[model samples]
Target: MTPIIVFSVITGYFGLLMLISYLTSRKSDNDTFFTGNRKSPWYLVAYGMVGASLSGVTFISVPGEVANTGWTYLQFVLGNIVGYVIIAFVLIPLFYKLNLISIYEYLKDRFGLKSYRTGASFFLISQTIGASFRLFLAAIVLQIAFFDSFGIPFWVTVLVTISLIWLYTFRGGIKTIVWTDTIQTTFLLLAVTISIIVILSQLNLSFDDAIKLVTTSPKSKLFEWDWLSDRNFFKTFTAGIFITIAMNGLDQNVMQKNLTCKNVKDAQKNILWFSITFLISTLLFLILGVLLYQYALANNIPIPERTDDLYPLLALNYFGLLVGIVFLLGIIAAAFSSADSALTALTTSFCIDILNIRKTKTVQKKTRLYVHIGFTMLMFLVIIVFNSFNDASVVSAVFKVAGFTYGPILGLYSFGLITRKKVKDKLVPLICIIAPILSIILNYNSEKWFNGFKFGFEILIVNAILTMLGLWLITIKPKTSLN
Candidate 1:
């Protein structure tokens, strides 16, 4: 597709989202922005979570890695199913029971003021980086496909991308995102389904032939039993369980939408259905990955050095004009669905956790507006910084950071939920900070120190354990009774 056509496609898509924003935000209030007035339909939230969860990182990175990693990510997805079940049954009920706007409020109730702040602070730091990573992929795509033609610097593209999200989300917040994300999810699914069909038609391969090839190819290997390898099934599976719990269950962004459902039953229904779809959609991405590698080999196309670029390069340059336009829309949808919510979630957290705005209810609407704009700007800066230094696959980078950022969170929740013991609330901030730093040191030296025991997705598990151990140490002892 020509740059003009690509730009037009994006413009029309944004216009559609803006229209949805206008409709959704018509009677917006703090309740609408933070919790969607607790009236969102379970089904819409279910479908929309898929797009927000996958985002551009998964859209680009999953299929790209298929050539090398095969279907092993399915191990993580399987683990995620288990994780989602835990969230649906355990975490969802707790959030609804408390009627929480920010999930972090539970920490305050269970522990003390310090622990509450610690959980909210970790969420803020981790989510900012995670959201930035997701947005960076879309920015890269736009720069390559359209902006370069106009001699536009990458920063301008980043600004425009972040600003559009701010423009729509500042008013309605999660209320707008719930509707916008459903629309984004529809386009995302359409784009993937169309891209798969186009590739099959181009290769003249029947469904049976495609399946047969994927099953037989070494590139489609799904199991890694090498205990020393980073992609071992056990590590990936366990890590998948904890990562989901930490990133979605413990983190604000993912849980924010679920808390918007009318009640616990409705929210549980949303999560349960979303997990099944999340697994199937990811499976489709893997199938596409195998097809991408096979197609490249057959046509004598040189694979891009950074495998993350493979999907975009093939779609935009080789898949024909129609596929290019759809793929572009898919990525944009993925980007906005994720980033827009992160902005809302961040604003919600800051207003609730940091500023304690509920105490000063008079200024909430005005305060939320300023906080929303501040996060939008923060995300832009983070993306620009990432663009300068990013070298690893985005999926890998995100997971690696999650290992550090989410580790303390997973630890805090585990300690609070599993045990009825009192915590040294004042010590929690110190413990949360120390756990991640220790995790970094241990992850850095594990291979050399442990005779090639590599930490992959399991880093989150290790970090959480360390955090729990720290919490255990700081518990108060009961005095002996002399009767």
Candidate 2:
């Protein structure tokens, strides 16, 4: 894998994405950009979402994490199935009934104007951070493989990465993403499948032998019954459910695609199918992780200090030229599938939720185009900032941040749906801010305060609970109607 070959593969891949954009964006308007004219096929949305849901973080980080955590992450994946079920039955119907362009609009109907803005603001902040961190992972890989040889700086890599996403996404928006993601998902799965085959060949293991190796390895341990450990099955499983509810059900990035379907039924079908496929995809990644570690051990290769680097290190240095190319393609596809959608969702939230762009239809198109460009720059800058300070595993870092930021959203939506009491709208923002802060304090001191209990993804559940409590304390009963 010369730098030239890596660059060429990326160039060809990006060209395909731009071609899709050109085809879908023609005669596109605000309706198409935001909702895909509400005519997207249910099955395509299901397929594309598999790519978006996995993102670059899952592509590289999840497999790498398998060495340390083993199959405990699957507990969280099972929880995701429960969460997706809730989204399909509970959240989808609400968004559909409201005919929402931005899912946050439900806050306005349920609470008030301030609560609406508060929810949208939280989403903007959460998505910006989440998307930036994801792009940062991809940019690092690109810099190592392609740009460093050319003496390009990291910031330049960040700019080019985001700029490429903006180029394909600026016009077509969700309309284009629905189709492009399907293509990206195809490549992503192919890359993973091909890599598995190549690695099995290198190790001289047949398919049955490979399965036997992964299943019988110590890394195959999936259950943890220790109540005090963060990886405990109950804790991780519960956290996965809430994480999905908050990150997917309440997230504009994920829900925007779901909302593109023709109706509630189609959207539900998409969620159900996407959930099943996503689970299968995740199982494959975990299996690949087991194989990578096994191959390294048998070859007497020292594993990298960072688990996230294992796949890249082996593929580029030892797996020969073809595996190197497959690695690059898989990562690039995963990166764009996630980043492109995040950009669109950020722009959509800003225009609809922050600036009320829908109210000013005359200039909405121009305004949206500008906002899209602006967010692209913002993400580039955020990625640079993250690069300066980030040291932890990115997969852990992303879920940690999501726990804090998405907590208020989970709390807000739960309150609106489960209760009839009216809230003090002006104070909602303060409660949202306070809940995560309290969660941080508790998480930092969990061992002392709770008899050596460690928090994992379940921290998200705590944060949401605190937010719900805050909201509850501020609630007032609805006034009785006079007869």
Candidate 3:
């Protein structure tokens, strides 16, 4: 629990990551960095993705949220199961058939050059914001447990930790991450498993008793039949489906891992198996949440005002040494698993989609290195900005931002796939921009204007619909060709 122990654990973990980077990336090139030479194992990719998908937000925020919202988040996970199936069956085949390096390349083939860039640009923006939020959570925990003891500032902690991520990821890129994620995912799962065992032992509760304690507690309340609440079952389940489609199916970072699989069948297999394992991991975290609150109450520990702080506070100060060590490792693994992938995916997007260097061998490697460093710095700044203004739970904040940023992408993919109509390509960017702004406006006024209707994460669905409408307005008639 001391600063020295926390710092040492991080140091040792980072050293192991660097070693993995060295082993996996020794023979790496631009091809390996971008797509892992299309040779990653389906099973490992599926398992590691469990860690990347959860990230620091889920590690810190989800359990804390239980006291407030209970098992309502489980509805969203059920919807994610539905979404992941759609990705495996519907989206993966399209990417594979097109032979896409950047999935946004589908936009260019389906629509036009401008539409492609719009899609890629939105991904760049969305991934950066989302990645920053994850890293910000990790950085805050590190600052409190380690740096604060030495009077170090938050920015310095971010810079140093992010530098460590950049050091490991810049060379091997996604190739290293695939292997590294497997290991990190192990640590992440272990953290949860160990916490559950420790809490159960401390409370003298067996497996059956723990289940009863959770179910019998008022905090375990799941469904909200009320139509207007943000966390209502209908809204969350529906929102989870769309959010996964947009955030995972449409996201370059998440899809990048899937694309690394050897072929279409492998990628689909990876996603299918990942959904099953991911559901198990999520349930474990929710169970841990219940145990954490119970532990706090029985021992006369005062809960922190912010749900995000509860796990860290209890583990570091109250839950004793072993849980504390595992907690730090788990959070670090969760944050870096996603952040490292995001950094690689962003660099890949810029070099391939924005710069059109996917075909050019010359200067591509050098250019990629520069872009990698540039995104690292950009994420550092974004984390600082988020730390300044983030008042809501990090999980809610991530999805709220995703609604506005990722919505246009969902619309673009839907428009191109479901309909053959082409749009005035030049207007695509304007439509993407306007859709999110309008969603924000509608969200602000919904209670009054919609007769006390509160928008949940369903705002993402509305934003995507508005974008599709805009695209339809700009559609040009498909020219009929005689066979």
Candidate 4:
């Protein structure tokens, strides 16, 4: 009858993951830790990324997004499919051709050390904040679920949760993460499907009937063509394209998995398959949300103050004991699928980028252990900072922060990869850093000057363009030598 049971089950699940991590990590060295030896199966990585990409934010936030934006978020998912195709065909091939350990290494080869470090440092900062904020959101959920029964402080709960992730990921890195993520994704999807069936049964409706009810519901209707508003079709699709491309294509955390594929062909296959799977899985969640809302309405369940709790609250309270357990499992599945990957990717990037450990042939286990622990503690610190703010929404704030930092990154890469014009390496970092700040200022008052048309995801597109322009302006032409 209390959250103690829920918490216990969740803790046990984490224990299982840690056990798997230890088993996988027993003899893992630097190559295995960072690249998974470039031997990971593409299918496994693709399937696992379904869960990693969605994460706790999607588990809670997608339902809330529906409540606010209707089913039009699917447009963004559609855009993601397009973005994935582009990455599979365009970006992955380039990365594979370069045979890069860290994607940022390409910048160094093309431009100079300053560009390389600039890109890598930006990723470290953004991903660290992004990953920490994600864990903080999940920790908040756990805190709320256990507030009465456990009497644990929020920060303590965060440390306990993150420490478990660190323990699992400290050794095997991507090899361990690939398999574990597949397991976690299974639970995530299964939990949602089971909860959906339970909610429908309580409504005395069959699965087909539930589908009909949802399609007819206002929330389930898709296709919004308005370009002037928040969830507009063009804007959502465009935003989706940019977000997925920037986040998945340009990001070290996400792309590291792709780069682990045996070859460019395999990596491209993974991206394509991942696109299909991600779209289908999200559709399943949205359908579950519609059914959940219908069940709540039919039974007169009181909606929570924040819509994020709608799905879980309905299952835990309205559907009662068995379904409550299932709901808790879903929440935990979504949260950990993401947290584990984030932890692994965070350590992998740091080891490869900031620390430059990958350049060496011999890295000690102790060094890797300390590196993993440092990132683990960093997660704790980031969550504390997020908690300190307490006002911003986790998903939106992350995107906003990303918009500033990642936009310039997108531009820098686009220029170097697509253009022949050389950029001044010394000025690259400064331009990349300043572009986002200026974009933020422009975006702040964009609507005031544009007749109430606010900038959306296109901000990243523009930000990247500006960086490209800056790179062009700052680069000095080659001079005639003494010959």
Candidate 5:
């Protein structure tokens, strides 16, 4: 496909998003922009989350991972269900009771200002890097498909894509995001389902035969009980728990949607339904990967050099132009599903938590407008910088960065909610810094030091442990006076 043509199709899709944003923004207030006025329908939020949680990173990365880990990645998603249940019933209630505008504010009330800023800062760092990496992966596919033709650099494509996202999302914020996410999620699911059907037809296998072929493939195996290794079934499962809890239960990006529901009960229902949809949707993608491998085997299609490119290559070669167009639409949908929400959430958190902007009060209208514009510009700048240095895999980079910030937040909340351990507010920053740095060191050298056993999911555990221990060292217990 021509670069201009591909660009036009992508632009058209985003234009639709822009239209939705325009209509939604007409009713948006600070509450709507930040939390959808706490009145959004649970089912729509749940449906939209499937796409937001997976994104293009999962869309491309999961199938690639399947080629290596078999179906064992599903173990993490299975673990995610346990984590999601905890968030729905346990975490959501805590936030609702606190009546928090920003979830991190609960940390401030429970702990102190230092702890609150620490949590929010960590989220800012992790979410930014993680979101950028997702965009990086999507940009790679678009570049390969179009811009690689005439010496147009990848960075140019990246900037243009970010620009389109920023333009549509600058005004409507979360109210717009909820609806946009639902639309994008629909496209993403359709893309995956259609790709499976196309690949099955190519193998001359009926749907039943195709599924049987996948089920029997080596990549289809799901369980590995080893606890000593990175992909150890138990370890990956545990990691899923921490990842879902830390990122969704605590982070602004995911919970920002949860907070939009009309009441605590509805928010809980939204989270519960989101888990089911996310789990089933990811399984479908994994099945597609297994079938893609089978189709490759049967038809003698050459697998791409990197597994991440497998879906795109197959779409381009195996399905002809029409199917390839559909695949492109899916890729765009997945990419924007997470990216747009991240941009909106980042702005929401920063404006509300850091700038003290309020949607409920109209007096500060001019200041809030500036803050929104400032955040939009900042996003454009950060994405440009992130796109320039693209050397790592999207998933690994996201987890690594997430580990740094999420661990400390996990520790902060755990300490405050589970115990009345009177933490010294002044020393909070040092503990948060030390915990993740130490965890990274352990993550890197754990294998060599521990007889080839390594920390994967256990890294979060260690990070949390280190943070807790650090807090203990810094906190001074008060003496109770006998009355």
Candidate 6:
């Protein structure tokens, strides 16, 4: 597991992605970059999304979390299934019927220009931070495993990380991502499966014995019935539903891929198939967590201070060179899968939603190329910032922040879909801003006011509700034509 081998593996992986990008970007246009010309195969999009949705955060953090929280995360995963179903039936039809390139266009048609820009603004901010945090985690791991050995600085690693993604994704956009993501997803899943097999062999446990071991272990406990706990099944499940809606259905990064499909039917199939694969993939990660813990306990190894470090520690140091290589590939694949798409989505949102590049129909290629490069730089700077101040668990930090930033998106979409009331267009920004602030205050003091009850991912639900209520306060009845 020398740094040279790790570096070589990463180089080879990036080369493959670049090749895919070149093939996809040939004779590409703005339509190809934005929507893949509405010609993407549903099955490929479904398979690729498994990697983008999970990202590097899930790759490293989910297994780390299993040691502390056991199987309760599965409750969140179940809730995601419900959310995906809603997207397939409800959101996909709306996007398709409107023939939307940017989903935020619905906001303009439903409300006004202010609402549309507000929605896109929130997404840009949300995806920028989300993408940076994800890359930050992956960069940190690379720094420790490879760069540190050579005394290479963290900032250089961040630049190289982002540069590689930009190189592959700059030209093809969604079209390229559709294919690269499938390859990355395959590598990610393969890495995890192989690591699991290696660990199982080390433990000398058959498949049935491994299943029984995890099922019977103390960490196997799944449900939390108490309402006061943050991990309460009801709270986590509800949060999962809203999180998926906000983070996927309303998100340009996720929805952009869905929009690349041939039609609503293809998009629906993609969502359905992706949801099923995502469920199975998550379950496998949870099982991997249980095995890692059992192996550590049996071998008298001390668990790392940060739970996220456990999988990397075992794969690199204890499991053998092959396992370590797999771990590196898995994490790099997970990171690139999400980051490349995020960059494209941000560029798409800004060019179409903010700058209205499609409407001008002039110098579109140049504008999009510049925006893509701009976002890549922005992401690099943000990841550097995260390295300075980040101390909490990466997965928890992502969801907690998402609850606040994505809350307005949830509220905006909920209001548009559920009511015919028109809101004060100029005041929409104020409402979106206040909702997350109030959610922060409430989350910070829930224990004092709610008799010691804590908020979990459910904070997202509360934030969206507050935003919706604020919108309702400013709503006015639609005027009918009296011809």
Per-candidate clash tally:
0, 0, 0, 0, 1, 0
What is candidate 2's lDDT per residue for 1-483, written digit by digit as tens? Answer: 799999899999999999999999999988899999999999999999998999888888998998889999999999999999999999999899999999999999988988999999998889999988888888888998999999999999989888999999999999999999998898779878888998999989998999899999989889999999999999999999999999999999999999999999999999999999999999999998999898899999999898888888888888888888888888888889988999999999999989998777385788999999999999888898999998888999999999999999999999899888788999999999999999999989999999999999989888888988999999887778999
Cα lDDT tens digits, model 6, 357-406, are 87784758999999999999999999988889888889999999899999
TM-score for every candidate vs. truth? Answer: 0.98, 0.98, 0.98, 0.95, 0.95, 0.98
Misplaced by over 4 Å in model 6 are 478-483
Task: Estimate the TM-score for candidate 4.
Answer: 0.95
Clash count, predicted structure 3 = 0
**Candidate 4 local lDDT, residue 353:** 67
Model 5 misplaced stretches (Cα beyond 4 Å): 359-392
- Model 5 error, position 96 (Å): 1.4
- Give lDDT: candidate 2, residue 182: 97
Candidate 5: global Cα-lDDT? 0.81
lDDT of 3 by residue, 1-483 (tens): 888899799999999999999999997899899999999999999999999998998899989999999989999999999999999999999999888778899999888999999999999999999999999999989999999999999999999989999999998999999999998899999989998998999899998999899889877888888887898899999999999999999998999989999999999999999999999998888888988999999999999989999988887787779989998999999989989999999999999999898667575788999999999999999999988878889999999999999999999999888998889999999999999999999999999998888999989999999999999999998788999
What's every prediction's RMSD, in angstroms?
Answer: 1.1, 1.2, 1.4, 2.0, 2.1, 1.3
Model 1, residue 474: C-alpha shift (Å): 0.6
lDDT of 1 by residue, 1-483 (tens): 788898899899999999999999998899889999999999999999999998998899999988778789888888999999999999999988888889999999998999999999999999999999999999999999999999999999999989998998999999999999999998888888988999999999999998898899887889899999889999999999999999999988999999888888999999999999999899888888988988899899999999999999999999998889989999999999999999999999999999998887385799889999899999999998999888989999999998999999899999999998788899999999999999999999999999999999999999999999999999877668999
* Whole-model lDDT per candidate: 0.92, 0.92, 0.92, 0.80, 0.81, 0.93
Candidate 5's TM-score reads: 0.95
Task: Supply the global lDDT for candidate 3.
Answer: 0.92
4 or 6, greater by TM-score: 6
